[model samples]
Target chain A: MTQIVRTPHEGPRAASAKRPGRSAVSRRSVTLITGCVLSGMILLLALVSLFWTPYAPDDTSGGRLTGPGAGHLLGTDKLGRDLFTQLMTGSRIAVEAGLGSVLIAAVAGVTLGVLAAFAQGWLDDTLSAFLDILIAFPTLLLAMLIVAARSATLGSAVLAIGLAQSAVVARVVRILVKRVLAQDYITAARTSGTSWPRIVAGHVLPNIWPTLVVNLALQFGLAVLAEAGLSYLGLGAPPPNASWGRMLQEAQATFTTAPAGALAPGVLLVLLVIGVNLVADGLRDTLDPATGRRRS
Target chain B: MTLLDIRGLTIRTTDGHTLVDDLSLTIAGGERRGLIGESGSGKSLTTLAVLGLLPDGMTATGSIELAGTQIVGAREKHLTRVRGTDAAIVFQEPLTALDPLMRVGRQIAEPLARRRGLKGAELQRAVARALEQVRLPEPDRIARAFPHEISGGQRQRVALAMALACEPKLLIADEPTTALDVSVQADMLDLIDTLVRERDMAVLFVSHDLAVVARVTDRVLVMKDGRAVEEGDVREIVRRPREEYTAALVASARRLESALDTRRAR
Candidate 1:
């Protein structure tokens, strides 16, 4: 019944109240803001693609393998589909797969990690061993296993990547939870009649969230990459569901004729990954003011 | 009258290592006793056993009767009820004992609201009163501030205030002042003394320093390794040494005090 109101991230006023003159703080904010812009651009592109993409995602009216010109913005793919339109469509899939897989990882990993934190002796050992084994399995191999077991589709591919990556998230959460539990404040809370659930929500969750968030953000970028790899291997979402990886796979054949097709998606993919990583690093600074001084 | 009674308590680690051996002690209502020992001497474990809050992979086998409730081997549901009502503990490191994320007022308000059923506005007033009781200046501001925002001494005061908010019959202080600045140690000890006397509450003060034990406790139990080496009246133990271990502890405390005194004599 007790509600614990916590600001997930501090507002601008609080951030400013800190020593804003510090170069380190400014640098992190710059990185964070830039990452936001990059991610926001893709998000906007995807949303716009939803309503209008200049041409249908599969439109092949334009001649095949055309270079950038007045009519074709970024040129045209082998199928004569508008390359810009396909890239726009690819952005939506990237965001969806990134978000969907991260959601799966966060929910599954946090639960398992917290449970392991609370577990003792045999249960704890078994869970830790299992998590390690899962983490050792490559994302592609896991995706292949899932695809073999079920039908290959976008959902299944995201599931495979998420399930594979969840072990990493769980491992991080377990360590964070254990550290939080060791703090004397946890004992103090217990002695003051706080229940376990309340302690987990109020103490354990809030204390470990900054690290957890950073881990999840990193996991997001990896999920996108894994999905792209899966798509390239012909295991991801089928046709009509154009992916940056699929686009890159198609472009490899006609690289000499139209390098834009390959360069466009490849650069965008790398940019998205780097942008997410920058945000994760920046978030490590911004969300954790208490540890900021020590880290900086 | 025997509010806190521990009989033949033994703590064993998972690998069959004994931490505390056959420890027996009792405190009547309003009586204060000190459990003195160096690090890893099992004094802290003894205190933890009183609340059934021992670490995982460690087991306590003995009777811990606190406010008429059996603590050892008690179910968590029952232990939860006894804790904060029968006894509350203030750990050594006060700065880390209070939640870094929570405002001090809300930290104190939890027990007040839970045990006393105090509502919103009323809970706020009680939190302010608790802070004032700790003699913290500008109670409102201190209540509003986070643990790191205040000094170590202030955080200890807040911790003491939280423990007292539940009005438990017994207060277990495990080296409470050890982590404070030297100047604030006296203030913290005095605060505990005054608050306990005002409530007529029993206290189990655990510390390694003989002088600290002498300052607040009526009786003292000297522990070495995992066994109780000596136990007697604080004045008697300090004046007439019965065991070599207790004598060494006394000699060290005397040396420390005289070193300070001789320097001041100049």
Candidate 2:
């Protein structure tokens, strides 16, 4: 019954007040800028692909499989379509798969984690057993099996990737949730007559969010790699539709004839993953109280 | 009339180990009582039982009445209401008792908002008054401060401020001054004692220190091996303890004081 009337800036204000003399913007600017720029580029690519492409990515008359030339920049693929347009459009699928898988993993993992910690006894044991079983299977193998069973649609492919990735998320989340539950603030919230839902939402969720966010960023990078692997193996987005993974598969066939075909998508994939990892590593270092000052 | 009445209370864990047994105690309106026992002697368990805060797997076959309402097997929602209104507990370690993440002002405001439905400026004013009651300097600044930024004594005072914010009929202080230095402990005890006297609030001061119990309580209950072996006036418990356990506790207390006296004399 104790209604906690939140002051608008209570959390941020207290954090800032505690560390006076430092600007909030300066505290996390580098990691924030890198994460934001990469994420923004990924988003822009996805949105732009929905409306238009520079050229018809599947058109034959555009080049008839020619190399890099005027108008047909970055050459053409086996289907005589522009590789640059195809790759640009292909960015959407990679981003979607990565983002989609993360969303699924986050929701499933966090819910299971919080529930397991809060609901002890049978519920906890049951969830723990299930997560253990799920984590034992390799993510790629599981996704492959799922795609084979479900007939390989984009939605099913993402679902497969998500299910594969969620095991790791669940494991990490369980540890963090367990730690958060044991914190004195949680005990204080309980003693204050805060309801169970409020305790989970207000007290539990906010405190565990930093770790979860860092995990999500790290997981997204892995999911992108995983999705790309699946697509290359012919279990990703269906043919005629653009996918970074599918593009990589096509590039492999034409590796000697036009190295850009394989190299462009392959290099982009590596850079994106590295960027994500760098940002994730930076976040992990920044958010951790023990090492945060060292970073500063 | 008694605000809290515990008669023949016994609490046990799932393993059938007795944590508190056959313990009878009472706190009438405006009375201050002390429950003195060393660690693991069940004084803290008795207090938690009164608040209905024993963790799951722990069983209590005891009558814990708060303001005439039995809370031993009360529903959680019912117990929740009882906590902020009828009775509240102040933990020994205030830094841990209050959430480190929350602002001190908001922590104090929780009970008032819960029991009295205070909001906005009224909530702020109530928090300010509670801080003042605990005699915290720069109440406004302290309100904005996180738990870590404050000293141990200040944190305990904040915990006291939180416990008193609801204006409960009875306050259960579980070694509230133990974590503080001797001088700060004295100041904290004085603050709690003065507040209880002024507001006519019954207090259950749980501690291991006999002298501290003697200073603040009218009656003392000495517990050992999860049982209340002796119960009487504070001075009588200190001077003429009947039970061997109580006598041993007093003896140890005297030994510590004489040791300190010897050190100070040099």
Against the true structure, whose DockQ is highest? 1
Instruction: Give the docking tier of candidate 2.
Output: acceptable
Write out fnat for all predictions, comma-separated: 0.45, 0.27
Candidate 2 off by > 4 Å: A1-29, A47-52, A61-73, A138-151, A281-296, B262-266
Kindly provide the TM-score obtained by chain B of candidate 1 when compared with the true chain B.
0.99
**Candidate 1, which CAPRI tier?**
acceptable
Summing lDDT over every window of 10 consecutive residues in candidate 2 chain B, give the lowest-scoring window: B93-102
TM-score of each: 0.93, 0.88
Model 1 complex DockQ against the native: 0.37
TM-score of chain B taken alone, every candidate = 0.99, 0.97
lDDT of 1 by residue, A1-296 (tens): 11212122211124334343588777888999888888888889989988999888878999999999889899999889999998998988998999999999999999999999888889999999999999998888888888999988899999998898788899999999999999899999899778889889988998898888889989999999989999999998888878999999999999988999999999888888888888888887777656665544
lDDT of 2 by residue, B212-245 (tens): 8887889998888888888999888788989988
